[model samples]
Target: MPHVEWRGGTCRVKWWTGETLPNGRKRYESKGGFTDEDLALQHGMDMEYEVRHGVNITNRDGAMPMPEWLDAWYASLDLAHRSMVNYESVIRVHIKPYFSRHTVSEVSIMDHRAFKRHLADVLPSDNSRQSVLAVFSMAMEDAVNAGLRKTSPVERHRRRGKYKKKKRERKKDMPPGAVETLARNAHAVFGPAGYAFMWTMACTGMRPAELYGLTREYCYPSWPGSDLRADPDEADRYAEDMLRYGKGDGLLPAIRVERQVQYKDGGLQFFPPKYESSRTLVVPPFLAEMLERLLKEHESRWVFPSISGGNLRSANFDHKYWRPIADGAKEDEGPRRPGERLALPEVPAFAGKRLYLIRHGAKAWLDEDGHSRFAVESRMGHEVPGVEGVYSSMTVPMERAIMKSQQERWESLPDRLGDAIWG
Candidate 1:
């Protein structure tokens, strides 16, 4: 039993318990006992709080093993299968081996410093550190929520800076001509499968996941209370009619956000788009007609169905197909500047280019064609947070108008800029 005694104006507390700690040594938990009763009482209160609340009395107090706490945290999480897999992967590959034996509450400033140093010194890439930090923060948050610690130690850490390459302004975006040439080449290489996929991405700005998730059931032909174009052949005429009469005196066309498709569970599940606002977009006659054509031609229940008639894997689509096609086209197109000196004389002319160039091309066209940021960001489904989100909704109609105009600009590119990029 621990003992406490007061003598004169001083107080002394002693630990007489014979228990050994994990390191197989006795712990007094105190030394040079308080000379005042008030200080002694406060220490007693702190000790009680530590016992009841599991709060770390000090950073080096040695409460529980890091691996044990991490395991408990993992077991408690109600997360998706993919999310759990990712979390387990990060903990196993990064956190466990380094921190497993360390006591959770006893982890010192030195340990943290070492962790940061290890990340900086030996991490294969900047993203590896970022991923580790993300998992560490999550686990620490769990500790706080469970009342295991007063606050997250992991919260005290931050990445030094964004990756250096990320800090640089991205290269100038590809022009529309280059995008079409690539699309044309993609069509030639993969036939309708590639052409349709590229065109859908270009027109909708939908992510690959969203493209793969598109279900026929979610494709709505008519906006609310809007005229239904039952005949796909007359969609163009119907679009013109709506433009002329849907709004008073044909002054401004009635916005017809005709259809949308969404993916859930990374495209394993399909659903209607949640981002749809009350506002609608005015799609052009050509696009409406194109959609009509696509709907008529494709018999599958998916707009952009997978090769196996299921959702397409994003990696397979990009690597097995997109890269090869883009690289081949780049080879056929020759060097960006004729006889341009390059580091890899042996690398095929197309070896270094990325499929992301298609996305960049669309953005460049949208910006150059005078489309507003609101329009582009909305089309891209970027959820700008806080006040920007409100402003986007208020100004989204102008964005729709700009997008309509941009689409017109895209339609014209294949003819005007065809030779500039392809030749």
Candidate 2:
């Protein structure tokens, strides 16, 4: 049995560790801060039970330095080389400098708050600070499990909790004809192919990876083969339209978005679209005609291929074409010198915006037209939520409405730009 004894004013609790030392003595542990004998006795019994059950716990009088614990914890991790390198970088740059000499058991709540304040000064944004804090907290959790400390000292918040939101103006979506403006700039930069690529991405709201991976097999004017099944109620209507589409006389055209090109094992590979959302996106009539022309003009497998006739890597495309098209390029300030090229004016709508914003712009356009939520979400490769999503399905009428609205938006472009596109 564990025991409690009064050594003058304060009482101490003692417990056997259920271990035997090399010298043939029983191993014991003790704590001596309790003033009440009854409390000390209860604590003694609890400690003895825990020790007998082999439950490892904090050593109140012993310590392990944070740096030592972090190194040990990292060494014990079995992770992919890339992931391990990332963790090591965070530990070396953000963690070790602040808590180098502190003990695992002595890192209190105040230290955590102080570290956060330090991070706020050193890190550029809240997200970056949180990411670093998460790495440190993960290490602290391992330390606790290793019995270097009783519990993690790092503060935690509910995943969705926000203490204070940063106040900033919402960015405006690209307006109706802004896509055409980008398409025009692209044409000026890389000729007809660039123009076609920009129009396709803007019109379909396809992710850059998905667009880069687009091949002849999945594009419009040829996809949605005759084998496609329509809702039973609309079977007759679907059959007539599909027959016409196959015969090259129909209005509806679609793209089957299945796979995207991504980097894996240091090489390009095909993976399912984000969230594995294999879908068919309807296209505007103008875009359909444009894609038809472009495909007929090229025999390559990809709908859009780089000069090397392979996948369009983002780094190369962005630097050589996208940036010049979006941000414009020219001499800094003085008069043009010899061998100086003429300037390219920045596309105002996309001057400081990202390429992914085009997807968001497409969504805004669909929503502005008051299309059904199911149809809009389906077109955007998003899964609708709640019972409505579970029970509802995209129908022929929904697709037709989307096509009509998109065609209208395309036709509304000014003749100055419209003439340039067609001519």
Candidate 3:
């Protein structure tokens, strides 16, 4: 039997049993000295009831604390080391600062809504809001799983604030001349390194990270051994290898995208592609020629190797390479011709001028070259009605048509840019 009682100004608990504990002593606990008789008696009675009923009174508070539970939950995730690190960073940076004081049970929907609104207001970038919310939701899910609360306030917040559904509007892709200008500007401003980089991106339509991870083995000539004529089965073997690496076919011949290069722990490393089928993209004739030249000249295995002979990190590429080219390409809209200026239609000052002229560039090229939405979509790796959007399963005819259209548009690029390519 065990009981609680008043002892002086405090409560005392006492228990008695016939059996001994592990120490081989008689089982008896008592509060011999008690100043508050009532509390002592009540405590004694409660202890007696607990012991008689075989109830556990200790360790009820051992339910994990919110912060401790969050830590444990974070550790359990099998995410990429870099991804896990970033998630923890987001918690420390945004979530912990505000929610640290409250237990998991104390957070309500109102609190979550307020936090969301505050984040929306303070964080100007939409992407930042999404990132912060993801971390917040993960932590709240952990709390719910631990039975700290009825439900996660974060789940409610996310459900309520899901992305709005709208008519699927096609993105305005870069105009026909724009990529060529980008290439020319890259060359004129950045020289050989910039030219090659921009040309590769424009021609392949591979994301920057995809290009950065390219290796010599993935490039043409060597794997197939240069002589497209000498080796009868070279192209087929290349195509087969390309398929194993997730390519639809040998459409992108010059350089294939087997993987991506990502920054982890502040260093460049190879990672799986963003999508499951990150395969080879057939290079156009002009770009393939350019790649062949680069491959022949550069001894490094990386097709688009950084100065460090490793994957080109985003920060380094943007600051050291891309920014300089953008800066050098800074040009003012030259003075409008007198006749053209006078011909321009006038509108009320309050009405903002629309940039309808921009769409015309892409539209004109597509129309002139007999390109359909499918062609444009294919070239830009856009999601089709039945496909995963970016990576197509097999569309040889479609891909070829798209490439031909893009080539025409690219060739029609302004001479200013074309002349900038020294070689």
**Top candidate, metric lDDT:** 2
Q: Where does candidate 1 have its weakest 10-residue lDDT segment?
A: 340-349
lDDT agreement with native, every candidate: 0.54, 0.74, 0.56
Residue 247 C-alpha lDDT in model 1 = 28
TM-score of each: 0.63, 0.70, 0.63
Candidate 2 lowest-lDDT run of ten:
331-340
Per-residue lDDT tens digits of candidate 1, residues 1-423?
345678766676654223357998865554335787666766655665565554534333346688888888888887645467678888887788889777776555567668867878868666678778888878877766765566666535356545555433245445445555555554444344445566545555555545565544333243222444544985675665444323233333223333343334555453333343212344444444444455566577665544444445533666655564565533434222223222212213223565554555556656776666766666555666677667654253564565476567567764732233222
Residue-by-residue lDDT tens digits, candidate 3, 76-180: 787754577788887777777777666666777889888988888878866788898988887777665654554678644235546776443233445544445
Tell me the lDDT of model 3 at 327: 36
Output the better candidate (2/3) by TM-score: 2
Which candidate model has the greater lDDT, 2 or 3? 2
TM-score of 2: 0.70
* Per-model C-alpha RMSD: 9.7, 7.0, 10.2
- lDDT string for model 2 (1-423, tens) is 878888888989888877778999988888898999888889888887777676656364237787887888889997644456678888899898899989888898789888988999999777778888988889888777777776788766634345687744345677766677677666665445567788777777889888888887777766656334423775674565465343155446887787888765677777778777777777877878777777786787888866545667643666665776777767442222233345767777777666777787888888889988888898889999999899998877888788888888777776534356555
Alpha-carbon shift of residue 404 in model 3 (angstroms): 1.2
